[model samples]
Target: MASNDNDNSLIAGALFLVAGGIVGAGVALLFAPQSGTKTRKDICRFARKARRSAEDAVEVVEDFKDNLSDIVEEVGERATEILETGKDMAYGAKKKLLKALEESGEQLEKQRAKLSKLVG
Candidate 1:
């Protein structure tokens, strides 16, 4: 998944570089003493293409953001469930220990009473 993101970033960067180059070339042409009408037309065309490319890039970034958010939420939920399960297990173990201790104490008291009866 990380590699995929890296790949996407690289592709987006390359596309931006190409778009910049196109705009730069168009600007250079516009300044090179061309007919005013032709220069305007060329600039308009380049502007439209650049706009489309930028919108596409925005869409890609939005999709990546949404997917990352979903993954983070899922991980958070799983972590919470695991924590709850651990707490339940700990509580059960503590209860079992307390019960065992109570039983042992009762047995000791019974033995003491029997011994006292014999001694008295």
Candidate 2:
């Protein structure tokens, strides 16, 4: 869980960096006062750079998703193992309890027969 938070923070940081870079470039282009054609070219080049950055971010997200899936699978398998272990322990305990009860009943019957013989 802590790692997820750290990952989210990293992703947010990357997004902020990308946004700041785009904003900085726009401000620079607007303040430079170049010819219209040159300004358009600069904007196009910056757009390409932004696209690549976005693609890289997307790839990172995809990889994160894959890793998360694997983690979930591992957790699920572990939970199943824990559950089966608990069930096996419960079954053993139940068998022991039943056997104890049966023995206790036999001892009680023997005691009652002895008391009847003494009273008679």
lDDT of 2 at 57: 88
Best by TM-score: 2
Alpha-carbon shift of residue 38 in model 1 (angstroms): 4.7
Model 2, 30-83: lDDT tens digits are: 789789789889988997999799779867976986898799899999999999
Estimate every model's Cα lDDT from 0 to 1. 0.84, 0.88
Please give, for residues 1-120, the per-residue lDDT of candidate 1 as tens digits.
Answer: 895787578667857776887778786977788799988888888778877877787777768777877898999999999999999999999999999999999999999999999999
Model 2 misses residue 37 by how many Å?
5.3
Q: Candidate 2 has which clashing residue pairs, if any?
A: none
CA RMSD of all predictions: 7.0, 5.8
**What's the number of clashes in each of the models?**
0, 0
